[model samples]
Target: MKPAIHPAYRPVVFRDKAGDFAFLTRSTMTSDRTTEWEDGRTYPVIDVEISCASHPFYTGTARVLDAAGRVERFEQRYGRDGGRR
Candidate 1:
């Protein structure tokens, strides 16, 4: 709200090399490197290791652990045989 107290807001590009994905968003972050966008304007670029494109959940490659099944197996093996309730 104060003059010169807020960081400069600018359009920046986030690149996910692993997933070959890139997106543009406004941020206070800056980069020494820049690239010309589709509109022919150069903007600061930020490299990200993980994004929606590369994330397991977003990519539909998440792992499901069977913890409940494991617990049942443990109870059958130990809890019923001289084990406390």
Candidate 2:
């Protein structure tokens, strides 16, 4: 409703250094870094450490430990591994 009060919601390019992935989306963030986009227009280029592209959880690269096995081992020492009843 207010003029110039809201941030610029334009397409932005987010680059991941390690994963070598670049995603384009609309964002209100501003940056000084510029790069040539697919449309042949140069825009601000922002570098990010992690995103859904590089994150372990999103990529299913996260290691899942066996906590249940560890709990059973601990119960065996406490003499409660025979049954749960």
Candidate 3:
């Protein structure tokens, strides 16, 4: 718990450039950019390429692998296509 040893933890805005989304949060990151928030206060703004707002996983736009189809294809090739053992 040494003073002045830690980076500044302050409120900053993270803007997702692709998704056009922005949010305010506290972090130790610094930025040379500043923007006026909805609260009429100027804070350091960091532009990110992707965020939860735009990420495929978080946005539920990710393409799910067809494991079941592959398994069925394998079973058919192995002579186990729903036949009784």
Candidate 4:
């Protein structure tokens, strides 16, 4: 609500190169890099390592951890009594 004290919020682009995905949204973040969006206008672009498009959870490609197997291995190594003896 202050005048000129807050960072400027403007249209920017978030790019996920690995997923070949990009989106335009309003953000206070700035960048020297720019890209031409679908609207033929240029906007500051930010490169992100991961996004919903490429995230395992969002893509339903997440690997289920074998917790039972790990527990079995640990028991085998230390015994059921945790090797207290």
Model number with the top TM-score: 1
Model 4 CA deviation exceeding 4 Å by range: 68-85
Candidate 1: tens digits of C-alpha lDDT, residues 1-85 = 8899899998999999789888999999989999888888888999989999999999999999999999889988888564965
- Tens digits of per-residue lDDT, candidate 4, 1-85, equal 9798999999999999779899999999999999999999999999999999999999999999999999999999989999788
Which digits, one per residue and each the tens of the lDDT, describe model 3 over residues 2-67? Answer: 998999899999999999899999999999989999999999999999999999999999999999
Give the clashing residue pairs of candidate 1, or none. none
Least accurate 10 contiguous residues by lDDT in model 3:
76-85
lDDT of 1: 0.90
lDDT of 2 by residue, 1-85 (tens): 9998998899889999868798788898899898888889887889999988889999999999999999888888776845656
lDDT score of model 4? 0.96
What clash pairs does model 3 have? none
What candidate 2 gets wrong by more than 4 Å, as runs, is 70-85
**Residue 40 alpha-carbon offset, candidate 4, angstroms:** 1.0
lDDT of candidate 2 at residue 2, scale 0 to 100: 91
